[model samples]
Target: MSTPHDRHLLVVGAGLAGLRAVEGARAAGWAGRITIVGDEPHAPYDRPPLSKAVLAADEPPPVPALRSEEVLETLQVRHLPGVRAEALDTERRMVTTTSGELGYDALIIATGSAATTVPELSGVRGVHVLRRYDDALAVREAMARSREVVIVGAGFIGSEIASAARARGIGVTIVEASERPLERAVGPAAAVRLMQLHADAGVRLLTATTVSGVRSTDVGVDKVELSTGETLAADAVVLGIGARPATAWLRDSGVELDARSGGVLCDSRLATSAPGVWAAGDIACVDGVRSEHWTAAGEQGRVAGANAAGADAGGATEVFAAVPFAWSSWHGHRIQVVGETTAAGEEDHGDGFVLYRRRGAAVGAVGINSPGPMARLRRALTAQTNP
Candidate 1:
């Protein structure tokens, strides 16, 4: 191991969580050599806008860099853009990348996730998955030229893509396998309201349906066949089914990973099974739970970074226990869900907010275009979880 004077901190996957991990290390008083690696050449950028503002913009927007080169320079962070981590060797504390081998005193795995794709539509033109910056640009260009867009899955990403397509005056059809859109996300009561919002927006909602096959020409897709013995005309298709954590590189790294999700398994302190290693963001499965939201990723990154630094310095590590929170916008209406809305008793106010209770006490909430109630409910949930 390197001495304290020559200690180094290496961060893989230069996304939101990776950027925050660097910052968190500095905030925790880590003065070691810091290096961040990213498979993408561009700097870290916000992803939520890719489905919303980026697609709806008349002109292509600039790359939404989360941090400037100057900021990274000020932090003394050496960023290795476009360098993919190929493998890891926890025994030697070395990471094999596309460029060269990297040794670190402490390592943070923040690879985040990649968009899940349809197997049948593989290598077909006009099929898109919005996870990277390039994917969003390609989809935006496809939306501009297409007349009708078929989005698979009615989750938050799919709904936002539908809203963006409609904003461009393009016809949208959302094919969801679930009976109700967002049924598992915001629960049944709130999901009904969300479905109404989509219907009011004039987007076609095809529930209990699955894409069976696609008819593609030499140039692009022209039609989509559903499982219900129905086919829909489409010039473009967007797959928003879900995302898998980017953890294939860690399979043989001696790091414990969740078998189902392929996420790195960590404790409350974000420490991995391997020594001198920690995981955060989407790739982190903390106590058997993995959160894919943006807020959770950033929060986990901060905590993991501090803990990794503390491990190097023999300092006290902090626990990462917080109420889950996520927010999304669909057709100009805000949808916010906080805490565990799945198992709690829901109280629909019929206004715009639904409160979730357990044992006569508030535990969570889902707000539809109601920020005031969401704010209050989130505060209450935070207090409840903390106390």
Candidate 2:
């Protein structure tokens, strides 16, 4: 192992993945000088709560810090915030940022993704997208003053926003382009239940619909134009259409990227094509698949950091292979999913049963609600060595 004297690790992006990368490097016994660069001004914070707790909260909840102040103090990292990485110079082992250039012995990228928005709604007032704390605050402010809210997507984010809007007695109408909401993620069985849950909660869900355009008044957006030729009055419009990986800065960086996801192409170990470079989080597509789940990002970061640190010290390194898992909350029910439930699977039990979703010979995924089933499947999945 190299002595603590001749090492410097630089992490780009300050999300969960980037934060974990620094922590993982430390845990792997690296005494290098660690530096974290992020475009955002704030420190690392949890994002999942932005769509749920922040929207329906009676009192504005405290900022959700993923790495607490106490935790940050322990990490002992040098943070350069509000500085966007402009380019990467792999040959020189330097990153060109908006502020200046940063050099590194090893690098980890976890730039995450950007919230997708409609170009047609560009420059229109009251059109919002939620992907950051500031976005959540803006949406919360808009929701507080709005009556009719048009959510232009039916994915988990849109559905969660609808639930929160309904909780505040605001009229919510979700316009989904797919034939059924969450058709790609959960298939028809679970999708139907989620649909019913939304209907029961007094939220209007429109499927197989697209927003052709928006009609805005001088003050703000007042209506949403639909491809179905029906225009609905809206006090505000929230775009939850989706997101794209934040890979624009790496376009000319000579790093291999997946055209489909626009994410950094990495091997099973989360190492990119460039030597001494690794990627994690939504920015990384490992083994031809990019996982958008929070847990997967953290795991990938851990592996990337460990490998980067170990390689610098000529020590041991580990591969990352965490089972994909995600959880969603809506209308007071907890929805937990493991692996790829959409894959062809055999049902071990009837509908609403847990510990099912057996694909080929292995249990590919499990969807559960209650504590018992979720606990069992979580433990089983966690113990597995591979995805």
Candidate 3:
């Protein structure tokens, strides 16, 4: 970023965290020239809705973009869409892009992530992922025309896809590796109702099965191979295994990276090993926090942006693991989980989430699916006395 008299901020990615960081810079009195670079052709948009609202729509969702043109005009920033960062020349303080190398006093690596496409699925004529807006559109079109869809994961992504498919009169078969669909998230007990929801909607929930690969036949998608030596024919496949970070550009940037987790190791100040460099969002692996959470991403963006823009970014970042939470909707049921109910614990593992006492006097319940228990449970987390 340049000086206030001659403001200049070069944001690397045009995703949510990138835009927020640039806005933070501008708000901190940046004036010269603000440039945003993105790998996607489209402007910044929210990804959560792509799998739910945008994918079920009749036409490509014009649902009014999440970004405001005034934010750009007010910030006096230039946007360069469809450009990827090739490398980082920290010595020269410049970022090499597809267009050309641009110098920056400070840089934010917010290259969000990409959809993992499976080319190994032979004749998987209409397989798609739900990470990007375009991917959602493609999946929407395929689902509209498909009669049967084989979703490869029973995670939130796969379950949500099955929900959307069932809404459009398309048959959905969810193949999960564990005995329960969301055993890793809500535990087996909580996942029972989720599976029941799918069954109520006539969805074929295939548990304890894994999709080895897919083979194309004369028809659209001929068959899907299972490790169990079972073959199932499908019209389309949606692979929602999981996602990795988009931190490939920082491979040699001297910023300590955790290759296994696909994230950058940030200190308490949100600064990386490199000076004047801060990282956040899914790419940042902060201690005591999991990757890929809306709240965590927002907190990281705020913390890193403040420090990167010369503001007091507070002291050591707190281990803000309030509760490992996630919410999903299927067949009109709103299922919200507040804590990690996915561990191998007994009925009440002290650390695990469960219905328990308020504080001293009485017991306050805590269950992933029941709302009454959740209500009192949240109260207990805040209150010191009995409810």
* Collision count for each candidate, in order: 0, 0, 8
Model 2 clash pairs are none
Off by over 4 Å in 3: 1-3, 117-119, 122-124, 217-219, 311-325, 339-387
Better of 1 and 2 by lDDT: 1
Local accuracy of candidate 3 as per-residue lDDT tens digits, 1-387:
324555345777776777777776656545556688988888776667877888779887763344788867776778898998988777777788899888876666677656555557633566677787777888888887788889988888888898999999998888888776665565555566567778999999887888887876554576778878988777888988777778788778777777577677776556777766777677777663445765556556655655566632222232223333446677667666654354444244332235322223323322434666565555565353322
139-166 per-residue lDDT for model 2 (tens digits):
8888888899999898888988888888
Error of 1 at 116 (Å): 1.0
- Candidate 1 least-lDDT 10 residues: 1-10
lDDT of each: 0.89, 0.83, 0.68
TM-score of 1: 0.97
What's the TM-score of each model vs. the native? 0.97, 0.94, 0.83
Q: Which stretches of candidate 2 lie over 4 Å from their true place?
A: 1-3, 59-61, 346-351, 354-362, 365-368
lDDT of 2 at 41: 82
Ranking by lDDT: 1, 2, 3
How far does residue 217 in candidate 3 sit from its true spot (Å)? 5.5
Encode model 1's per-residue lDDT on 145-232: one tens digit a residue: 8889899999999999999998888899999998877777877888888888989999999999999988888767799999999999
lDDT of 3 at 380: 60
Which candidate leads in lDDT?
A: 1
